[model samples]
Each structure stands twice: as structure tokens, then as C-alpha cells.
Target chain A: MRKLYLAGAGNVSKNLLSLISNLNSDIKIMGIENSRGQLFSEESLSMADINNFMKSPEDYRKSLNISKMDFDIYVDMRTASKNGERERDDYINLMKNGKHIVTANKSGLANFFPEIGKASSEFDKKLYFEATVAGGLPVFSLIRSSFPSFTVDSFTGVVNLTSNFVMKKVNDGMNLEEAKRKAMEEGVAETDMTDDLDGTDSARKAVIIANSLFHKPMRLKDLKYSGIDENNIKKNEMLLAKISMNKEFSVESRVFTLNSEDPFLRLAPMGMACSIGFKERNPVYISEDMDGPLETAGAVLSDILSV
Target chain B: MRKLYLAGAGNVSKNLLSLISNLNSDIKIMGIENSRGQLFSEESLSMADINNFMKSPEDYRKSLNISKMDFDIYVDMRTASKNGERERDDYINLMKNGKHIVTANKSGLANFFPEIGKASSEFDKKLYFEATVAGGLPVFSLIRSSFPSFTVDSFTGVVNLTSNFVMKKVNDGMNLEEAKRKAMEEGVAETDMTDDLDGTDSARKAVIIANSLFHKPMRLKDLKYSGIDENNIKKNEMLLAKISMNKEFSVESRVFTLNSEDPFLRLAPMGMACSIGFKERNPVYISEDMDGPLETAGAVLSDILSV
Candidate 1:
């Protein structure tokens, strides 16, 4: 039986915890952590206790005695934030402790690609992050598992769900402020909404894609990106943001408007879409018509099963 | 290191052999068989020998001294036909001999699922056929790898490329015969093209998808289907055919004309597309803009690596 540790008590983490119990009876959740605290158990946490723990803020992370504890896998489902930096450190430590890491946190990968790579290799720990970019759509794994022999010509996608929602609303005649407000109300956008609007989120996703698909290690700062918030367009200009990379494997992401007749210009408001082109075959298009939360959780669970 | 066997000399199989040499040096082709003949080697087949073996067909299959031979995996990339039953028997025998099987042949699974499933489990062999339905699209593996916990609500797709090609051509102001001829010229449709035009091909694909995605064991005879050839409609009524299934997990597929504004009706002539809905998340769309040659080979290589 595999023992698992979950980092973060956010909606995605909670959803993942709920799923792991029902899917595989042999695997047990050994611990859970959030910004406020953590709880560890030799026995699995009951559903009621899992929910209660999500709401509770008591720190019991150290109770298990980290140096002496043993678990097979550590899943990080935390969102990108300053808290994520600390989680990233913990992830490194967990890898050193011989815990296989599965993550939905882009910040963990986008910020520390080389360090994480070295640590995973040093400890012989397998690290996977399918949820980092377009988690709802299975683009990364498709390339990794299905089309490894094909030479990738290009990859382009609308990776940011919040910005996509805001843009769709703007196209429907809502002002930018109202659109952002609506995205927040729908629980798709964060309260600040800066990451979604400023292109950093998409840039981070682009970096992950470039690294995973093209073996091009890129930082979020290396991307040439421009956000949607900085632009003011007329009614005719309906802008959408996408992260794009060519055969050269350089990540270039920007917000732009396309003519209506372009086949690739179809957009979904609260979803993610991507097209991966190969040298030997036609492009593969993956489009997800869902918000981020459930898909993120699903992607995390997928990585868990993979590990 | 893995010992591999190629079970066909068709375009897709030949392409796969070409790719395996470049992609992974650890995997070696131990044998190859076609209707014309077979080739066997204890050592890896040289590139020259592989090409020569594909071109030369002098029956040496039984000469391998079956009782003395050993191989780890068998990949069946043969197209579905009368000869396929013999190949299916070979698959069963290979599994009985402890060879894990990967296939692109729908007939093997669609027709004899129970027998194949029993043989695989009884012998503890894995039978994977990711290249069976819409081999150009990574739908089955995507669902298997990406969404493990989500309950599938529905699966719908334009599974047959020939029918899609014909429909696109008819919409472009060509008669059915002309459209079919065009598809044949493009090598997307068979020379006879009866299976594609009569919906039998799509029905076989539906059976595969039903079994793989919905866990519904269905056969070609179980589906309600009508081919494009049986339909007669006005030129103004542009028509497209798609295979569709709902939460009932029953296969209800037919060819029909649709209203112009239906977004789902839009399709590429040489591509495959499918949308999968789940209980928790919104629908995920997988679109493939190519036929089964390179993509099918890619899918086979994927299953090969998986084993």
C-alpha cells in the first residue's frame, strides 16, 4: 500500500483527498498541509475529518516528526503565491527524503526547474506535474506518452482561464472591471486577478510546457509576454491571450485579437484550449470547457496515480 | 531492454518500425509478420534487415520454433479485414505465451472482447489498444491518464474520417460519389469504401469507445447505425455524421443532417474529434487533424513504451 501526503487544503487539494479515498482503497492519505497548519495520521482521514481539517487552522505538521516519517508520495496542490515558495522548499526537502512528488503548483516547477530536476535525480524520486498547464486538457501527457517520436513543430494555447473569462465577457460588451468582477464571482478568478491579467500565469504555464514538451528549460522571466490589463481596445477589437512556442522552443505569449474567420481563433470563456503541431502529422487540438478547480484536482489525482 | 514484435507490414507498421529505431535504443524488434510471410531474429533486426524484411515476405513464422522462442511484446497494426481473425488468433496465442499486446486493430477487441479479456487476465498479460478508435486522437489514453476519478457523462465524436471527408466534400458542392472518390484519392478512404460509407466502420469504432470509455461491452451488431450512402438529402441541407453516446452508456449512433449553427457539427475533412463530459467538470474536447497513418503509428509506439 502506498502512503500519500497532500500539501494545501485549498479546493483542489480537498477535492483530491475526497477522490483518492474512493478510487483506490489500498492507497491512504498520510498527511495534509495548508497555509495555517497540517495534520498527519497513520490511518486514513475520514471524509468528515478531511472536510473538518480543511476548515481547521491548527498546525500539527511537525507532530509526525518529518525526519523520521515515511511516505511514498507528496502531492502539492497549492496555488502560486508567496506561500508556494515555502511549499517549494518543502517539496525539495520531501524529494531529499525519497518522496516521489506530484504537483499542480506551477510555481514549484516554473521557479525551480534545475533544482527540482537535480533533487529528483539525486534521490531517484519521480516528479510529475501534469496540472501545471491546461490541466483540464491532457496536452503534456499526450505528447509525453502518445507522440514522443514525433518532432514538435509548435505548441500554442489559451492557458489562462480567468483571462479567458474576462475577455469573453468583454466581447459580450461588459467593461474590463465588470468582467473581472464577474470572473471572481464565478470563483474562476482570484480576488486580486493580477496573475491572470498580467500574463505571468500564462508565462509560467508556457515555461512548464516548453520544459516538458521541448526539453527547453525556460524561466517565467525568459518569456516575451504582454498582459491583457495593459491594453484598451475599441469595441471591434476582441482580445484573447495565448502562450505560443515555435520549433525553436522559445516561449512567446501575448494578448491579441484575431480576425473572426481564422479556424484557430475559436475561444471558450471559462476553459483552456491548445494545439500541438508535429513534423509528421497534423496538429492536435485539446479544448476544455470547464473552470480550473475540478480539472486541477483531477490533474493532481492523475499525477498521484502516475506516481 | 524490451523485445518487440511487429504484426503487420502496412504503412502504419512500417512507419512504426522506422520510428522505433530513432526514438529508443532500448526497445528492439525481435520479429515481424505480414500476410505474405514473417521474419524472426534473436538479435535486434538491423535497419537494413528491417527494411528488407518488410519488403521480403517468405513465411518463416513457424520456423522460429515456437516452443524455443521468447518475446516480451506484440504490436498488432494490421487493418481490420478477413485476415484479421487469423491475426486475432495469433494475439490470443501470443498472450497465452506471456506476450503483452498492443494493437491498432479494432476487430480484435470489438469482435472478441470477452475472449481477449479472459485470455489476457488468465495469462496475466496486458492487452492495450490505444490505437483502435480514433488512433489519430489521444482520447482513450487522455481519459485513462488524466481523468481517473470523474464519472463520464457522455462521449461523442466524428470517429470516421472518410465519412467526415465525404460530408465536407458534399457541403463543398460535390455529389456523394465525387466526395468518396476524393477521399479515396487522398488515401483517407478505402478503395471499396463500403465500410466507411455504410457506417459499419464507425460502428466498430463506437464499440471500441463504448468498451474502453463507458465499460460497455458492445459489438458491431449492437449499434443502431445508418451509413451516409443510405441517406438522400437536398443540397441546401448540408449534412454530417457523428457517433454519439450518453450517460446511459448505451451506443446510439446514426448519420444525420444538422442545423448550420450547431458548433459541434463543424469538422475537418481529414481529422478526428471527440468531446467527453464528466459529472464534476465541464466537457473536454480532443480534436485530431489527421488520419491514422502517422498518428496510428505514434499511438502504437506509445503503447509499446507503456508496456
Candidate 2:
């Protein structure tokens, strides 16, 4: 049985718990690891044990998080920045003690890589945070593990859900307020969507990635930030549709190509795109990929599993 | 210092040695595992060490004919059919006795999975073979080590360079022989391209991947085979270019897409894709974000400095 030390009980953490509760008998995920450090049973935690110790792999996995659940790896999906800091310190200590860590929080890596990395080397424990940048996409593992022989030249993306959502709506001929209204309702734009709209979120993702790709790290403040809102408007529904269908690389590449097709120049307040940023280290351009959920989630899941 | 046993020094084996020899000091890859077994290194060895007393991750992997290298992992890159019964049994005994086995050799997994897996479990040894499938990219660590939570849908890709090369040329107007000749000259097609074009190469790679992903024993013959040939193409350069950057959807709902907009893809002998494979098991995929060999040589030089 593996015990998970879940520091936060947010939507993602709860979802993760739900995913694992019903795993096979051979691999049991005990209750959350808390400051009290008490473990819980499946019934006590209210999570199902789908494996039944003898069920088939597919059935076991469908009912549970994975047919072969390995909760020996701990997960931390906290959204709080302060908790992210605390979690980083805790990871350092745990790594020194040979404990493995899996996290959805990007702030963990953005904040404390050197300390966690040194301890991981000394203790040989795993510290993975693939979910920090991309939502549910296997991005980190692809760069970190699979292609150990390669070095990244640069990273750029079309990040910022609010910016993308707002721009996308604007291109469809909707007014700024109308787009914001729809975005807010659809959960596409946060009530305080300013962070995403202003390119702060994408900048954060960029720096974290720069650090992960190479030993030399970059800071969020060092990036060239931009955003797209309702200013530049002349929608080609055909172009948008083609781009969405992956036929046109124009807008896809436009996310980071500053001074040329800059999304921020076309839109503002409700959208943003921070072009490539480099400060005293390797240059990288981190933006967004795809429309929903973000690529960070899948990557975090993959990184955590490396343990 | 890591000891490696190259059971068969074939195409992949030679390539792996070159890759390993070029590694830095942090990990040492000596020579083939059987250098001592052969008794006379000068006769059978390429990079034979005179004093073989040192055994561990501390030895320098400063030995290679095709390149300079060192490795801390054992890699078997031979085909199963090439390995004799004696070598097969001997390899099993080594694995059973707690020696690590890292190989892309089909027979190793086809014949010795259960026993070796049991032995690895008991001894806490690892058997890593990232090159077994998709020399195009790394998938083993991605699935097995990176994402333990997600259920893999299935993998699909243009795994055979031979077929890809043939199709590419034929699509660009070259005849079968001309395409094959060009491929062989470019080292893109195997010396025996016939097998790959016929789909046996893909079968081996798929089998190795399936065996690992499912954790259930299966053989090469278990899979339903598919192949690509020159006859499938017509003379259409524009369409050829468009198809070269293709995408394949997996049963898992994830899409595998490639971009040939880059110059390297345009110059390559074949236009191909290798994607996530495995059903009801966890899967791994590569990212478009990753940069391959940002000047491959410089990276290796830096690795040497690290060692």
C-alpha cells in the first residue's frame, strides 16, 4: 500500500484522489499524507478499491485511477502560492529522506529547483512537476526523459486562456464586453482574468520551462510580455477555422513572433502573448498550446509517475 | 562506471556504443559485457580495455570505433534471431543473478520477460531499453517511468524508415529502385530494407513496446501486422510535402502530429511518424516543444566536461 501526502484538498487534489481510490489490490493508495501523518483506509477515505485483488486490468483501471496504482509516489496539487513555497521546502526534506514527490503546482519548480535538485541527487529520490506548465499533456517527460540525448534550442507557445478566448471571440465579431461576459460564464475567463490576460501566467510558465530545459534558469520578470485583447480586429472566419483545424500555422506561430502577427497587438486587456525571453541564460519562448485545460496537467501527471 | 554487455554488435549495438562512448564522466560505460568472456579482447573487441579490474560507474567510457563514449548502462541492440541459444541462456542467467540487462534485442524480451522481470523485482535492478522501439524518439521511460496514471489508448506511427523512404521518393516521383538506392546511400534505409518495407521491423518494435506496456507476456506473432510500400504513392510533390507532416489519432483520444516545416525533415530520406502505442496500459508521447540536438556535437562535449 502506498500513502499519498496530499497537502492541499483543492479540485485537482480531490480529482486525483478520486482517480486512485479504486485501484487494484496489489497497489493500494492509502489516505492523504497530512501534518498529522495519519493514513486512512479505502472506506475511511471514501475512495473505492476497484481492483478487488483479482479483477482484470481494464476493469480494475476503469473503476480506479490506474489498473496498477502506484501511490508510493506522493502528489501535491495545491493552488496557493504560499503552500507552493511550503511544499517546495517539504519536498527538499523529503527528497533528502529518499521520498518521491509528484505535483501539479508549477510554483514548486518555479520557486525551488536548486534545493530540491541537490537533495534528489544526494538521496536519489524523484521530484517531478510535469503538470506545472502543460495541462494533462505529456510535455515534460518528452523533453526530460525520452530525449535525454537532446538539448532544447528554444520554447515558445500560445498561452493565456483569457487572451485566447477573448481574441477568439473578438475575431468572431463579438464586442469586448460580450466576449468577456461569455468567457466568464464559460469559465474561460476568470473573474480576475487579469493575470492570464496580462501575460503573467504565460510568463511564469516560460521561466519554469527555461529552468527545466537547461541547468541555467531564467526569471519571469526577464521575459518580454504581450497580450491580445479587442484592439486589432478584422476577423477571417475562414483563417481562424483553418488554423483551428491545424491547416494554418500562421496564428499558431504568431503567438511568439513579436513585431509580426503579435496577438497582443491585435487584442488587449482580455488577451496576451509574451514573446521569447532570455536573461543571462539560454533563450526560450514559452506560450500556450491548444485551447482547453492547458498542457501542464498531462506533463505533471507524467513527471510524478517517473518516480 | 557501468558495465555493458553487447550480446550482438550489430547496427543498433554499434550506434548505441557510439552514443554511450560520447557520454561524460558522471556515468561510465565500459565495453561489451562479454569482452572478458571472449578472453582475448584484441581479437573480438573494438574498444578493448587492457586492465578490466575496474568495474562500476567510475570507469571511463573512453572507447569506441565509430565514436568516443562511456555508459553506465548495459544495452543489447541485437535482433533475437541473431542471438544463439547459448547466448540467450547465458544472458538469462546473468539477469537472474542480479546483473542489469538493457537491450533492444527482440529475443531478450520475447524469450526472457517473466524470468527476468521476476529477477529484477527480487534484486531491485532496472532493465531500460528506450531504443527498442522508435529510434525516432524515446517511449519506454515516457510510459513506464513518466505517466503511471493515464490509461494508454494505443500507439501508431510511420515506424519503418525503409517504407517511409520508399513512399517519400515515390511520392516525389522516384521509382522504387531509385528511392531504395538513394535511401541506402543516405543511411536512412537499412542494408536489408526489404524486411522493414515488408513490416517485420515495425512488428519487432511494436512487440517490444506491447510487452512492456501491458506487463503481460506476448510474442511478435501475436500482433496483426501492417506495412507501407512504394505502390501506395503517386507523383505529387505538393501532396507529398503535405502528407509528410501528418497526424495519427490513437485509441486513447490523443493525437500524434508531426511538422516537416523544418529543414531537417525536408532533407531526411523518409517522412515518418512513431506514436503512442499500447491499449489499456499507460502511454507516453513526445512534444513538439522539444529541440533535438541543438548542435549535437557541442552537447556531447559539454557532457564530457560534466563527467
Best by TM-score: 1
What DockQ does each prediction reach against the true complex?
0.73, 0.13
TM-score (all chains, Cα) for each model:
0.92, 0.63
Chain B TM-scores per candidate, in order, are 0.90, 0.62
Our tally of clashes for model 1 stands at 0
Cα error, residue A108 of model 2, in Å, equals: 5.9
Where is model 1 chain A poorest over a 10-residue stretch in terms of lDDT? Answer: A234-243
State how far residue B197 of model 2 sits from its true place (Å). 1.5
What is the DockQ score of candidate 1, to 2 decimals?
A: 0.73
Which stretches of model 2 miss by more than 4 angstroms? A1-3, A23-75, A82-102, A108-127, A158-189, A233-254, A257-307, B9-74, B79-90, B107-127, B215-217, B222-226, B232-272, B277-307
Write the residue-wise lDDT of candidate 1 on B1-307 in tens digits.
Answer: 8788887889898778777867855888888877777887887688788778766676354464442366788888765764246656877888887789888888877776766777888999888888887776777667767787887767777778887688778777898778878998999977887777777777777777777666666666666776664346343222222334453446755665556644455556687877787877788887876776777888888778777
Q: What is the C-alpha lDDT profile of model 2 across A191-292, one tens digit per residue?
A: 877766656665566656656654544444445655553466444311110011112211121233335333333432332222232221122222222323
Two-chain DockQ for model 2 = 0.13
**lDDT on C-alpha atoms for all candidate structures:** 0.72, 0.47
Instruction: List the candidate 1 regions with Cα displacement exceeding 4 Å.
Output: A42-52, A59-68, A83-87, A229-231, A234-247, A263-265, B59-68, B230-247
iRMS per model in Å: 1.4, 7.8
